[model samples]
Target: MSGKTRIALVTGGSGGIGRVVATRLAADGMTVVVHYAGNPAPAEEVAKEIAGAGGSAVTLQADVTEPERVRELFDAVEQQFGGVDVVVNTAGVMILKPVTELDVDDLDRMLRLNVRGAFLVSQEAARRLRAGGALINFATTVRKLALPTYAGYAASKAAVEALTPILAKELRGRDVTVNAVAPGPTATPFFFKGKPQEVIDQMSKAAPLERLGEPADAAEAVAFLAGPARWVNGQTVFVNGGVI
Candidate 1:
């Protein structure tokens, strides 16, 4: 990299993992665009923290599943920051249910937000990124474990995984790297809300690391992929702490 201020667009930047990724990237000196789907408060909070820490950041609201909105999101980033150097797709929805109980609408929603959203964001990033930039997509360890009630969500992540290789090839000779990060049972609000403490404890003990993953832990991996890791491309770095 040329040591210029790099720009990063993190989708779902208002949420737990996304917030950590955005903050960490900013701390690493990358100008961050915190993209949120519905709520802007959390995104703005993150942006303010970055600024307070002497880093540059901005909060933007956009539904990644919408092509026009995604285009606008990137356009605004380009207008403000010159161009994007890193793109992370953390926008996802989980509607857990057995395959038999999965509603068509729910399935469509998962596919739209998880699969199509990643594709659209990656496409735009590929089109706009400066050479040596990186694109990181969020997948899940559920694809490996094949857990019950997560078929739809897992399938969506699997689609993301499948796209990484082709995207890497498509971006060949451009010096931009594409990759995915799959986190397992992280200690995010989404994983803890409404869940029994006993169940959470048991789940934590199942991982080889003997605790739930932290958002910062996953964000660390994301940071690596975004900068100074150009050699690691077209791969899924599983951040489940050795969980099978």
Candidate 2:
């Protein structure tokens, strides 16, 4: 490629695992675009942290589910950086409920962000990313574990898993790899929300590693797909410490 620095757009980079992934990519020397849906404060903070560490990063806002907004997000990045080389789609939501108790509104919310948002972003990445680029999407290990109260979330992530490999093949000859990172029971604030202590304890120890995943754990996997894992394409790399 040219001597220009690589550019990476990380959706939902304002918080949770997305924040760490943005930070990690910046540290690895890619110019990071931190994309947030609503709030810009957290996204700004992430950019500041990366800047302080001598890494290049800028914050951008977009409703990822909206095609126009997603295109704008990439447009801004490309206009400023010349072109994007890595696109990490970490923008998504999770709503836990048994199928019988499922609230249709909650399911729609999850699907809209998790599946539709993922598709819009992936579509842009597939069309625009530079050669040798990579697009890493987020999934959840619960899809395979088949846990209770996760039907809505799992179904949405299942769509993410399903689309990953297909997108990789579609990008054939472009040298850009498409993959998903399925994190299991990560200890983000969102993960602990609405869960009791007992339930948290149980999940923390479910993995053979005997603890919940940290955002950094998942970030490491994304880093691999974003950078050195050249042959690893169209696959969901489970970052759950073997929970399944």
Candidate 3:
């Protein structure tokens, strides 16, 4: 709020989609804080790359599931950069299985990171971000596809989609926008893990684009929502390649 440079804090910045979002925002002249949970190496590399490219960036580690840590995350941004302008919550866990074979532990993990972690990061963003700030949360297009194996994971993301509008409304007149990005079949480590190549190919063909989404594809949407899309709020923009 005190500096001319806009500040953006991207959670899960060590990962595929998150890292791209952080990098893109920094390229747009926003000071980006790359947040990681357990992994620091990737976050560090991303930050280094940004600085090398003449963009401003800093890497921070925080467990978004912890309220104190989430609060401190915002505090660090405010303390160092004067204030935060955009908060992108890309931290989440995905566990896929049909309802009949789903493990409760997997479901719990999904809710903990995908739902609870997102809420915590978004909550802090709402409290600390200056006017014109934007809060972007990650959702999944699988929810609309109604994919059978994603029962547990989709349910968790469903909660995230459901929260966007309410949070946006609560911030009414504050000039803060709250929204979600639902990416489908992205070519990220998080998506490739545990899946066979054949399944991946099939899903890719499911999209009219006939390919898995690249991290940049999703980041482009985030960049727009994070900045000039001020009139767009309380909505979930699907980043799938015409799948849903």
Candidate 4:
């Protein structure tokens, strides 16, 4: 690979956990590409933060659900950084509603981003990633817990889990490990939004660890998979503090 610096493209890099993952990878010595969907400000801030910390990073925008945009994203990365060595598909949305109450439109929107977006990213990664690269997708621990009102979100992430190992097998000789990181309740603004204090407290204590997962905790797992956990393939690593 010409001894070029490894590059990592993190989708939704502007969001809570996504921001942390991007910085963590950059700190791990990879040139980071912070990909955002709608807003560039946050993404640019993340890139600048990484650069300020003496790491290399840049911002890119792409709607993961769109094929052409995703392709262009890869093209830009390849042209600028040589080639992508890691892709963390953290771009996803969660719409909480019980099965009976879930609006079909909301379900469709979530599926479009969470499932289809993941597929598009995985497809491109399979086609373009360097031999030693790894593709990490996002899943959720709710898929295993089967919590109420999370039916739609859980279903979407469940699909992600299903495709993970299959993608890994399909990439057999390519040497690109395909895996998903499933995070439990994490201490992110997204997690705390609109939830009551009592509810948050109960969730915080639900895990045997007696606390909510941190963004850095999830970031650590991603760093492991992105760099040294080459032997871990086609599996969903739960970073939820034993929450299931």
Candidate closest to the true structure, highest TM-score: 2
The stretch of ten residues in a row with the least summed lDDT in candidate 1 is 188-197
lDDT of 2 at 130: 90
Q: Which ten residues in a row have the lowest lDDT in candidate 2?
A: 1-10
So what's the TM-score on candidate 4?
0.97
Instruction: State candidate 1's TM-score.
Output: 0.97
lDDT of 1: 0.92
Residue range with the least summed lDDT across 10 consecutive positions in model 4: 1-10
C-alpha lDDT of all candidate models, in order: 0.92, 0.93, 0.91, 0.93
Q: Write the per-residue lDDT of candidate 3 for residues 1-244, one digit (tens) a residue.
A: 3348899999998778998999999998898999999868999999999999999999888888889998888888888988899999898888878899988988898899999999998888888889888999999999999987898989899999999999999998899999999999899988999999899889989988899999999999999998889899999999999997
Q: Which stretches of candidate 4 lie over 4 Å from their true place?
A: 1-3
Provide backbone clash counts, one per model.
0, 0, 0, 0
Show where candidate 1 strays beyond 4 Å.
Answer: none
Clashing pairs in 1: none
Residue-level lDDT of model 4, residues 43-122, one tens digit each, is: 99999999999999999888899999999999999999788999999998887777989899999999999999999999
Candidate 2: lDDT over CA atoms?
A: 0.93
In model 2, which residue pairs have backbone atoms overlapping below 3 Å? none
- Please provide, for model 1 over 39-149, each residue's C-alpha lDDT reduced to its tens digit, 9 standing for 90 to 100: 788898999999999999889988888799999999999999888899999988888889999999999999999999999998898899899899999999989988778
